[model samples]
Structures are given as structure tokens and as C-alpha cells.
Target chain A: MPHRITSARKLMQGNEACVHGALYAGCRFFGGYPITPSTEIAEGMARLLPKCGGHFIQMEDEIASMASIIGASLTGTKSMTATSGPGFSLMQENIGYAYITEVPVVVVNVQRGGPSTGLPTKIAQADTMQARYGTHGDYQAITVAPASVRECFEQTVKAFNFAERFRTPVTMLTDEVLGHMREMITIPESGELEVVDREKPDVPHEWYHHFEITPTLVSPMASMGDGYRYHVTGLVHDQDGFPTANPNEIKAKMDKLRNKIVRFADEVTQLDVEMVDDAGIVVFAYGTTARAARQAVHMAREKRIRAGLIRPITIWPFPDDQLRELLAHVRRVLVVELNQGQLIHEIERVAPKTCKVAGLTRYDGEVLNPVEIFKRILEVK
Target chain B: MMADPIQSSNVTYDYLRVKKRFPNVWCAGCGIGTVMGSIIRAIDKMGYSKDEVALVSGIGCSSRLPVYCDFNTLHTTHGRAIAFATGVKLAKPSLKVIVVTGDGDGLAIGGNHFIHACRRNIDITTVLINNQIYGMTGGQCSPTTPHDSFAATAPYGNMEKGFDPTTLAKAAGASYVARGTVYHVQQLDKLIYGGLNKKGFAMVEAFSNCHTYYGRLNKEGDAVAMLKLMKEHAMPVKAAKVLPPEKLEGKFLTGVLWDVEMPEYCELYQNLIDSFQEKDKE
Candidate 1:
């Protein structure tokens, strides 16, 4: 007997792929506002979520959308939201709430030119820094960037898994270029990918604490009405989940929240590397800029110039270890990003002390082509 | 007997969190405690178990009530309690979701969410404490603050007219709308009970006070004097219906102002899902 293979190839846009990926990850609720470039993700969710027995809501604004997803996630439902710059700005406060409460939610920021609604329909990687430090406070953030339509789907599911595993909000950062581009992506069969759910409390109901800090720095989460009647507050609280002004308790809670991401940075960080062996110049890029970097590497190879590309899938954890090892073999490093030297700062900080680091940036709305990166590669020589 | 609140408690204190002190963060003479008492009584009378109830609140003095309650409480960001409750109710329609909010939190910064929640007619109860001023923020003028009233921000006097929450909620399409005060404990309890019984969005605006702030600034004396003033001023909606239009002028009406049955947002969504599944079968 021959096994049948279903046609997995479908022409899909990046934002649309993100919607399907969220569905595959068992997302049951989505609350978000419609913004340029990211609107397709919301529209796709509205059409598919209800059809798939999920709930899709277009909130009045981004703040409510962010709060609503957190609310839904608290009930042990996988939830997400999608938005661009302006809407993402409105969600900052609640994003902080989701962080402090340790709620598992995925927020997709399809990047557009910003600073004050700079360009609604244009692609730019200006929000790389914002994704890390947008909300006011000290906390670790998990942000993944996708460069292709296939990854728009793959990375969105990964974002949900990370959110549930760490019991924190995860961000998927893409740009208008990838969000709008239509390409063929293989849809994996059901059960082909791994799905992670938050750990439920195995303790007795009376002894359950919502913020119980375990040795792993990740605590088990129980939804409302799970026979574990507990309190979830944004205030600094003790292990019992009651607000306290004690400095020792506050430090322990804050330290655990921050260290959870640090201790597991290797587990959370992801990078795609190519042609690094015996390379003279290594290019580090992310999001749409990495697409151009891939092409530039191919062009450099044809000209007999040794060029390598290291694309970061997980941007928040910075992929410092991977770059430190790659920088050792290279004479110089060229950091390419859509913004003006944002991730370059991280590269320069951790790059081998013997190697010089330079940045090739494009803050304007136009997407960087392969020629721009190729030109930078030649200049670095 | 009154001095020993724990001994003389009429309702079950099982739902109340034991960790928080008996004396909450409310001001010395604030009326929020009375309102909170009324809400607890209503929940007690409704016969809801502690496990089946979920209380959510936004930032403000009134939002602090959730911390003192043990029923799956979620103290959220400022002005987002109702929105959060909407998500909870939608996710678990079996849970009785309630929001405790203040005038400044619910009507000012959170006005958009408040109106949308009412418009959607989601099955959740919101007890809005209209204190006429932002007591938590030390007396800024709020949406429900009376015109020409003195607040810390409105030193010269407020220039805007206050809103009647019952009318605002009704216009926003709440299935049940009511207005009561801390002065009318029995009536407020009954109104909240009516809201809980409804299957759609229900709002009970309990006109509360900032005796430490509003009373000091307006010369309304203490908490007792403020309650007395509200008692004398508040007219029941049923009573106002009988009086002539001119005679009812300058009177604030209380009691349940509106009640109607409508398809709830979550239930409608569930039915919609069923309908979609039904189509797939055909």
C-alpha cells in the first residue's frame, strides 16, 4: 500500500500564514485592533477562528485587545493578538500586565515605519528596540522575528509554545514586506509539530499559590475555577500571591521573573547560520534584512569572496553565544538591519574583541534589496 | 455587636480573602465599604459558590475591593477590569464574572471599554462606584462629577455637566441598568441582585463618596452627613415616573432604570459556532 501525501503547497501571505499557525497551535481566542499590514492577520483570524470553534474579537482599541487576550489566556485558553505600530503602542501597558502576571499570551507585531505613525503601509524594523523595552518596567521579553512567509507560520506557533512554556507573553516581530508577500508554504500534518501547554498545579487546592516560585523559576499555572481559588494581581506580591511591601519578597519575585529568561536563554534563542567556515566577513541580520543578507552571501560566493550569514530567529535573547562563536573565525562583521544600528549594538558588545564590527542600516520605508547588502559586503573589505 | 464585625457577620465571609486586613485601603469616612458590603450580600443572596464566581477590578480605590475578595480575583490594570471580565466570561460562560470599578477608572479613562461592554451585552456584572471625584488620585474631577463642583483639578469649579450612568448604560444597550447609592444599602443590594440574575450585560452604578476629599472640599461634613445628603436627594425611578416633569426637575433618580432580555455576547458566539458546525454537517 502506498501512502498518500496531501498537497501542502498553498499560496499564502505572511500575515495569513501567522493566522493559520496560531490555529494549529490551538489558539481559541484573539482580541486585536485592525492596522495596516497586520490587518490581514486579524481578518484571517476573524474568518477562521469562529469556523474552527475559536473566538475572534475586534476590540475598540489595542489596550482592550491586549487586556482581553490576557484575560482569555488566564482561563487556560490559548490566545493571541496582531497589530502594527500604533496599535502596538496602545498595548504597552497591558503587555506589562501580562508580563507581571505570568499570563501565557502571544502578541504579533507586524512592523511598520513608526515613532508617530511614520508610515502605515511601509516595511521597517524600527520596533526591534521597542519590543524589548516598550513597556515601562524591568522584565525579560521573548520576541521572535520571521523573514519568510513559511516562517511567519512556523515562528508564530513557536511564539505560542514559548509563551506557555515560560508562562510569559511572547512577541512575533515581522515587517510589512514579509507580512504582505505571498509565497508557497508547506502546511505540516496535524501532530507534526509539538505543542506545549502551561503546567497545572498538582498540589492541594488550599495550598495552591499562583506565583509559587519553583527551582526552575517557572511556576505551574491554574486557571480560575480549577478548584484552586487564588488571586492574580499586578502589584508586587509574596509567594502566596497577596500584595506585600516587604523588600525581600519583592526582590525574590522580581529576581525570579528576570532570571527565568536568562537561565533558559539558550533554550529560547534560535539562529539560522550559513557558509561561516573560512569566511572573511560575517553578516548578522534579522527580519526582512536577513532576506537581503542571504542573497548577498550567495552573490559574494560567486565572486569568490568569503561571506557568511547569521539570521536571528529569536531577537530578544540576542543570540549572543552564537555570534561570539561565529565572530572568532571572521576578520570583520557586518550587521544589517532595517533600523539604524539597533541590533548592531548587541553584536559589537559580544563580537570577538579581535574583529571589527560595522553596521549597514536602512530606516527609510523602502525594503533593502540584495544589491545594498552586496555593496556593504564589498566596502567592509 | 456592630463593633465585632466578624461575630455579627450576617453573610458568609467565606468568599472574602482572609489575608487582607479587615480595614481596607478606603479613606476614613469613604462610602465604598457600604457599597462593597451590598455587593457581598447580593452575591450571598444569589447563592453563588465561591468557586463559581470570578471578581475582576481596575485601578482606583473601588478597584481595591477585589484584593479583599477570594473568589478567583484578578486585579488588573487601570480601567481594564470590564474588558478583562469580558474575556473571562467569554472563555468560561459558566463562571459568574463581576467587575468592581470606580467613576474615574470606569467612566473617564475606561469609558470606551465601558460603553463597548454594554453594547456587546456580554453576561457580566459591573458595579461602578461613582464617587464624583478621583479619590484614589486625591480628588481629580471625574465624568460623573457635578457641574460647578469643586475638585482638586477643578479648583475654580467643574465646567462640564455630569452624566446619569443609568441613561448612559441604557443608551449603550446594557440588558439591565440600575443606579443606587451607598446610602440605600437594601435598594443597592436588590439592584445588584437584579443585574446578576440577568443573562446579558448589567450595570449597577452605586453613587459612592470620597468623604476625606470631596466632603472636605465641598463642606459636606463627614461620611454620615454625605450619606444623609444622598438619601434625601436620591429619588426612586418608579417614584419619578409618577411625578410631573417640572416637579421631578433637579432630582436624581435611583432604582433599576432599565431591564430587557437580549442575546448575550458569549451565548450568541456559542450559538454561532454551533450554526457553523451545523452547516459543515449539511
Candidate 2:
């Protein structure tokens, strides 16, 4: 029945577009439990996946959901899971396992207000750091933040692409506002966008290894039932995918793991930069707060306050080089986010030393409208 | 027979990666070796071309079984082996998915996933090694720790009654449920073989003893003494039914306690897809 909804101009919710984007990205398996603000993704996947010849499983808990998706990904299936704050916290341990094992998965975290379930339905971006560091162990993360409903579609597709490209879990970090926000979205037809699948081992079975290192560093994966008969462990391993205790081998593996994301920074980073070429005060925002920052920048320009907006599309692999390049001519940078001061610290560390960086954060479970951000823009100047 | 690649190699080397993985990270007299041997033998007997097999285990001593196995192995986080195996099974229904978990890992922290896997009745075999204590973390009282047993954590003797995992699995709707002891090696091998061949969720709760921890703490002597005690107290469920109710106290019931066929999870899911595609045809 859902396949009959072929209208292109329909007002799709952010979470709905995310599911559509996942399907467009060739995701065949979704293993997720319901959580507030993120439940719609699961519901959408549950309803629409089978219609598309895909799989949807409502797992027992967040940990299982995380584990399940990783398992599915190991079968050379493009897999994903969705969760909000509390469930995301429960999934942190296994999330680390996915990291160390270098599995390709896209985890959708619809942010809600929380230290611990602080506001189930309210919008907040307080989990920015949690998404980066929630999982224990030494591995880098790839987090993508989507502000507009269109980005919810495109960024999710990119999230899948990056997950497959890096052979690591990529997070589409959307908040309650973006998740629940309804707006018209244009989803490209099949083959309109590039879809990536994880590379498969082309060598003979005797010579094949699961994490075989080449110039790409992102090793080609082998499915479980394939004749490779490979091993995958959460423990550090050599190229053969077996656990190793040797310090040199462990260090080499860990170095390659970290360097894979770091070296691909140029190709992976995404940012929305507008009018920052000559602005005195540039506003940096992400997610819900970026919505207001765009409006505030437009309003500030009307008054000739020389303001612009730089919204980070890729939040985890922080846009250090992009921010430095964009904020070169700008004098003051105002970061507006739903959280009090999460992303501002990141901008402070990366933004050029010449710029005066400030944060106009709202953590009171309220949206930072254009007026609030406009006030911050004026105050920063 | 010698010309065959599988038969040409020894049992352990045929099913495992290389000899470098052994001597396993196990102590002398560890019953886990016996259980691991049985698991490998069962896989060898099935002769499914191990590439079609995926052995997944969560973090624990028992979970380490996958690390030594040559098959496509996934050593995941603690207590979520069944959940991971569920993904493996659903993704590729043709693959024989097996989860190796310990009592604490399966019933304590991962209890939610364990029961849900049973309820879903997914096609996977879960071999839960119940050592009655946390062996890897040095003998803490596990969920299956017997009442009044001395564990490292329960130095004064445990007050809680331990869980019968077979009952838990059966109650949770696992299609096949069985219990076997490390002492009864042949019976355990058969139970595991039956479990692997079962169409839906199958659980074999093997009562393995941790001589280093639970055994020494409870004065059960060494591994041999513990095995001897288990052999004496082990009663077949059929045999226990004939015994007086009072005499059955403290005796472990062994054998196939539960077996029933139901609609398998992934197979039914495929039916759902076919029906949806049928609607699409209209």
C-alpha cells in the first residue's frame, strides 16, 4: 500500500525521509527497538521494508538492536538501527564493538532532551559528545547532523556511503525537531544518487583474510556464509581477523583504524557555508539550532550586520579544515546549538586563532528562533 | 576418506584456525575444553562446509569458543551473542548460526535478549555453558550459581536460588530445549547435535564446572572430582519421573526436556515479503 504513494511533492517528516533515504541507499536490514522521536524510523522501516524486499526487526533492547545490525552488516547486508537518548546510552557498549570490529552500519540517533530521559519528546542536541565518545575504546566515529528535511534524506544516503567507504559505523545524529519536523522533500529517483556497497574479497579462499590491508586501508569484507571462513573479534587483530596480543600488531591495527577516518577527512567532511566570505560575525550552528541560524543570518544581512551561517553537516569528523577556511575573513563566530556548549568547544579548538568564537546555546528545551539568534548575532558584533 | 580435505586434517585443526590459537587461553582441567571439543565435533559431523556456519559468542570464557574456531566467527560484546546471531540468521537464513554464551553472560545481563530470541523462535542454536560462577572474571556468583554455594563474591555462601536455564528457555518458547553435563560428554554431544539440527530456536544448557573457581571455593576438589559428583547426581528426566519426589532433590535433570515445531522467524518474514510483493503486483 505504501508503494502506491508515488507523489513526489508530499510533505514527508524528517524521520520518514531518513527511512526513504535508507531504502534509496540500498539498506536491506533494520534491527531497531522503538524509542521516542526515533520510533517513527522503526515504524517506517517495519511498514515499508518488507514491501521493498528488505528486513525489519524490532529487537529486544538497544544493545541487541546494535548487535543485530552489526551482525547483519557482517553478512554483506547494508544494515542500520535507530534510537533516541536512553536507548542510545544502552547501545554504547555494543557500539564500541562495532567500532573495534570495523563493521559498516548506519545508526540513527534522534536526539531528545536528556541527562537521563530528561524530556522524551522535547528537542535537544546534548548528546553531541555522547555520540562521539559514548562508546568505550579507541576508535574514531563518523557522525552526520541533518538540519533540513532534505538533508535528512541526502545526509542519510551519505551516511550509508561513508559507512561502507570506511567500514565503520556512521551516525545520522538528528534531533527531535528535525525528526518530527514535516516539510516537502524531493527524493531522487533510483540511480539518481550514488550508492556504495562494501567491497568483497576477490582473492582465492586460501589467500583471503577478512581485514586484508591494501592501499585503500578499508579492507574488503567477506560475508559469514562465504567460503572465506574468516574470523571477526572485538579484540584487536592482525590482517587475518584473529585476535592478537602482540603490542606491535595491535598498534598497527589501531593506527590503521584511526588513520582510515583521519585520512578520509577531506572526502567525508560536509558543511553548509553561506556569506562567510566577508562577514564580520559568522554563526555556526547544527541541527535544530541551525534552522534559526539561517534565518537570523538572513535577518542580520537585512540590517547590514554582516552575518553568515556555517552549519556542520558532518558533526563527528569535525569540519576543522572547512571551518578554518570559511572563517578566515570573518571576525566573530557565533555558534548556536540546542545544547548549552557542546559544539562550541569543538569550533574553538579548530577555528583559526584570529576569529572571536562565541556560543548562543539554548538548553531549556525550547527552539532557538531567528529572533534569539539575531540577538546573539548583534551582541557578538 | 584421506583424500578428502576435511578428513585429511585432524578434528581440532579441521574445525579451528591454526595450532597457534592453542593451547587455548584456558586453565588445566577446564570443562570448557570438553564443551568446545563437543561443539567442534558436532560441526564436523554436520559437514555443512564450515563456510556456511557462523559461530558467534559474547564476552566470557565460553564466548571465547568462536575465537579458536575456523568458521566465520563473531566474538561480540558481553551477553548479546544471541542477538548478534539473530542478525546473522535473519540476514542469511541458509547459514547455520550458533551462539556460544556462558550462564552469567546469557541469563544475567543479556537475559532480555536471550528470552526475546527464544520468543521470536529464530533459527539459531544457543549452547549456554553454565559453570554456576563467573569463571573469566574470577568466580563471582552467577545467575545459575547453586543456592548456598561459595563463590568469590558470595564468600559466606550464596542466599539466592540458581536458575534452571533449560526451564527458562522452554518457558520462553524456544522450540528445542535440553540440558547436558560435561560429565556426560556423549550425551552433551548428541544434545548439541540435535540442537544444531533443530529448525527453530534451540538451547542446550550444558552444566560445565569451573574447577578453579566454583570447585575450589565449594570444596568440590579438582575438575575430576567435580565431574564425578555431577555424574553421580545427574538423573535423566525420564528416570527422575519414576523416582520419589523427595529423592529428586538437588539432582540435575538431563535430556531433551522440550521440543516442538513452530513457524520459524525468518521463513515467516519471507512470506511477509512475498505477500507484500503480491499486493504490489495488483
Candidate 3:
């Protein structure tokens, strides 16, 4: 039997795909404030979520909207919130709370050009580092970047799964380009999709500790009102979720929280390798800019240059080790992003010291073109 | 041979979750304890199972109400209790969701969420403990802090106007809105019960006192004396009709001000699912 192949299916915009992805992921609660670029997500959720037995709430502001979704998720509902730069900034404190408290939440940050409302409608990936370290603490965050409408749909679902499985906040790090762009997507029928639920504690309510780590380093969650009397706090705490001033307890809890994600880096991180098996030059890219890099890689190959593209789907817990291996053979690495050299720094740190590393940076609110990336690749070479 | 008028059940207050420890965190004669007591009594009267309720709160003195309750409780970040409570309610609509937050937590830093939650009309009861100052943060100005009130932040006076939580909720499309003060104990209980029973967003703004913070700074007298002052200044909604505006001015109105039903956000979503299922069947 031959596998059925489909061609360029009519696609939805990245933001629209996120809405569909959330629906498919069993997200029944959406609390968000309407902001540009991100508003489509909220609008789609409001219009479609209700039809699927999911609630859509337009909160007073980004702060409450972010908090409400976290609240909704505690009741064992799949929940999410969408925001742009300013809203994302307001949500950082609670985002940190979500991190420390180990609340599973999907936060969609549709990136806009910013440093304080730089351009609400324009596109930029300046938030790459922000997504990894925006919240004010040392806790880890899982961030996924989608380059196209289809990836948006696919990755948003993945984001929810990661958040639930890890019992931590997962950021769908999208920008205005992918969020607002419309494209055709062939969504899989129900039951064909894989959904992951958070691991509930096997221990009875009386013995259950809310923050106790299992062998897998992931804590078993017990919803409130189940007779579990454990405390959850933003302070560094022991396994019981109670505040502990003990340095050892703090170190143990913090290490487990951070290392769980890092140790399972293989399970969490993902990237696309194209023409990389015998390439001398590698272009590392993510999100919308990755689209252009793909084209640039092909163009570079057409010119008889051995060029390849490494497109990261999971931006955080970055594929540093993988990049190190790829850089072993590749003579030069060109990192292209719609930001002022954010991920380039990560690449610089990961690349072999001998490998020539450079960045193709942009923050002009326009998507980087393949021509620009090609020019930058030539300049670095 | 005198008969005891108060039975053990009446004297015991079975709904009180932490009764063995009678004296709570509230100061003597503080209205917060009274408000908490009324909430417990109302929950008891409503016959809600302790196991089926989740009390969530933010960082504030009044937000500590959830800590005293033995139900599934969460003392979360400042001004974000409504958000956390929203999560709990959405996750378990079968459970009654109650948010206990002070005026500062709910109306100032959290004002955006407060109004939006009402607009969405998720089925949750919010008990806004309006003590007129950020008591937990030591007498700072709050969104509900009255105009010309003095606090640590507002040394001379708070020239800014205050928020009327009930009015804000009503304007924001809350399905149920009510105002009660600690002085109106029975009436407060009734309002709380009504709000709890309402199908959509239910907000009960309880005029609590912050004698330790807002009181001393504003010369509102001691805790006991401030509570007495609250009692003196409270006027029932029905009685306010005959009283002159000047006499009734600044008096706390105590009663169920609004009660109406609209489709709750969750139920509406459920209907959408039903409709989608129908389409699939077709």
C-alpha cells in the first residue's frame, strides 16, 4: 500500500492554527485580554472555543488574563492565555509564580516589535531571550517556536503537552508574521492526534505531597479539594511544597526543577535538519526567520555551496549539544533571527571555538528576507 | 434548672473549618473575622460540602481567609487570586469557587482582572474585602480607598476617588452584584449565599475594616471603635429610600443590589461542543 500524500492544502494563519491547536489539545478555558497580533488568537478562541464546550474570557488586562488561565488549569482543565509584548511583560511576575509553583500553563506570546510598545503591529523575535529568562528567577521554561501556520498548529499542541507533562509553563514563542499570516493546513481528524495529560499522583490524597518529585523528576499533581493539605508557595521549598529556609532543601528542589528539563533535553528539544549530512556551512534559524533561511540554504546550494539549515522547533533548552556536533564538521555557522542577535549568542557559545560564527540580525519590524540572509552568509564566509 | 437557649450545634458553628483555634489572625473587633464568620455560616446554610469548595486568595490581610478554611485553599500571588480561582473553577466546575481578596488586591493591582472576570461571567463568587487600604502592605493607597482618606502612601490625604466594587461589577456585566458590610452580619450572610447561588459571575463586596492600617493613619479610632463606626454608618438599602442623601451620605449600603442570570461562560462553551457534535453527526 502506498502512503497518501497531500499537496499544499489550504492553510490557516499561524494564530488561527494556534486556536485550532488549543481546541484539539482539549483546552476548555481561555482567559485573555485582546491585544494586536495576539488578538486573533483571543478572537478565534472566543468564537470557536465556546462551540467546543470551552470557555473564553476577555479579561480586564494581560495580568488578570494570565492569572485566570493559570487558575483554570488547576481545576484539571487545559488552559491558555495569549498576549503581546507589553502584556507579556506584565505577566512575568505571575509567570515566575507559575514556574516556582509548577503550574502547567500554555502562554502564547505573539511577538511584536518592542522595547516598550515599539510597534504593536510589526514583527520581531526580540523576545527569544525574554521567553527563556523573562520571569524573575532561576526556574526553567520550555519555549517552542513555529515557523509556519502548520507548525503553529502542530507546535501549540506540543506546547500544551510539554506544559502538562512537565507541570510547568510552556511558551509558544510566535511573532506577528506567523501569528497573522494565513496559510492552508490539513488538520488531522480526532483520535489521530496524541494528547498528554499531567501525571496525577498515585499516592492517596492523605500521603500526597504537591511538590514531591518522582523518579522522573516530574512531580505528581493533586488538584485542590482532594484532601491534599500540602502547601504551594513562590518561595524556595522542600518536597512538601512548604517554604524551607534550608539551603540543602532549596538546592535539591531547585536542581530537580531545573535539571529535570535539562536532563530530559533529548525528549523536549526538537529541530529540523536539511541538507546537513555533508554541509560545510550551517545556517541556524527559528520562527518566521527560519522560513527565509530555508530558502537561503537552497539558494546557497544552487550556487554549488555546501549549505544546510538547522531549524529549531524547541527554542529553549536549546539544541546546544546538537549544534556543537553540527559545528564539528561545518566550517561556518550563520544564525539568522528577527532580533538583535539574541539566539546568536547561544550559537556563539555552542559552536566549536574554531568555527566562524556570525549573526544575521533584524529588528526593523520586517521579516528577514532570503536575500538578506544570503548576503549575510556570504559576508560571514 | 435553666434551659440552654443555644444548642451545641448553634454554639459550635460546624461550618467553621478551623474552630479548635478560635482566635484567628484578625485583630480584636476587626470586621474581617466577622466577614469570615458570615461566609462560613452562609456556606453551612447553603449545604455545600467542604470537599466541594475551593477557597483561593491573593496577598493581603483579608486574603488570608482561605488559610483559615480547611477546604481546598490556595494563598497565591498578590492581586491574582481571581486568576487562580478562575483556573480552579474551570478545572472543576462541580466545585464551588470562592475568591477572598482585599480591596487593594482585587481592585488596584488586580483591577483589570476583576472587571474582566465579571465580563466573562465565569461562575465564581468573589468576596471583595474593601478595608480601604493595603493593610497587608502597611496602609498604602488602594483603588477602593476613599477620596480624602489618609494612609501611609497618602500622607496628607488620598485625593483620588475610590471604586465602588458593586457598581464596577454591575457595569462590567457581572450576573450578580451585592454590597454588604461586616456590621450587617445576617444581611451579609444572605448576600453571600445569594452570590454563591447565582449562575454567573457573582461579586459580594464586603465593607471590611482595616483599623490597624487605614484606621490609625486616618484617625478612625481603635479596631473595636472602628467596627462600631462602621455599624453606625451602615444603612440598609431599603431604609435608605426615606433618609435624606446628606444623612445617608457616605453610609455603606447593605443588601443584594443585583441578581440576574445569563449563560455562564462554561455552559455556553458546552453548548458549542454540543453544536459541534451535532454537526459531526450530520
lDDT of 2 by residue, A1-381 (tens): 233348776698999999989988989899999889899999999988888887899998888999999999999889999999999999898888887888999999999998897999999999999989988877688999998899899988999999999899998899998999999877787777888888888989988867776787888888887788877888889988888989999988988899889988888888888988878999888887888889999999999888888888888888777778888777898888888798888888887888889888788888889998898788878
Score chain B of each candidate by TM-score. Answer: 0.94, 0.94, 0.91
lDDT of 3 by residue, B8-40 (tens): 535225555443334566767678878888788
Docking quality category of candidate 1 according to DockQ thresholds: medium
Q: Give the TM-score (vs. native) of candidate 1.
A: 0.97
lDDT of 3 by residue, A1-381 (tens): 111124436567888889888888888889888888899899988887656666777766787777778777776778999999889998898898888888899999999998997999999998888899898879687999988888888898999999998999999989998888888788866666788989887777667778877788898887666656555566677887655679999898888889888898888889899998898889999988889999998988888888999999998888888888878988888988888888888888888977888888888888889998988877776
Candidate lDDT (C-alpha), each:
0.88, 0.88, 0.83
Per-residue lDDT for B46 in model 1?
94
- What value does DockQ give for candidate 3? 0.48
lDDT of 1: 0.88
Deviation from native of the Cα of residue A130 in model 3, angstroms: 1.4
Candidate 3: chain B TM-score against the reference chain B: 0.91
- lDDT (10s digit) by residue, model 1, range A146-183: 98999998898899999999999999999998999999
**Runs with alpha carbons beyond 4 Å of true place in candidate 1:** A1-7, B1-8, B19-21
Clashing pairs in 1: none
Task: Report the C-alpha displacement of residue A137, candidate 3, in angstroms.
Answer: 1.9
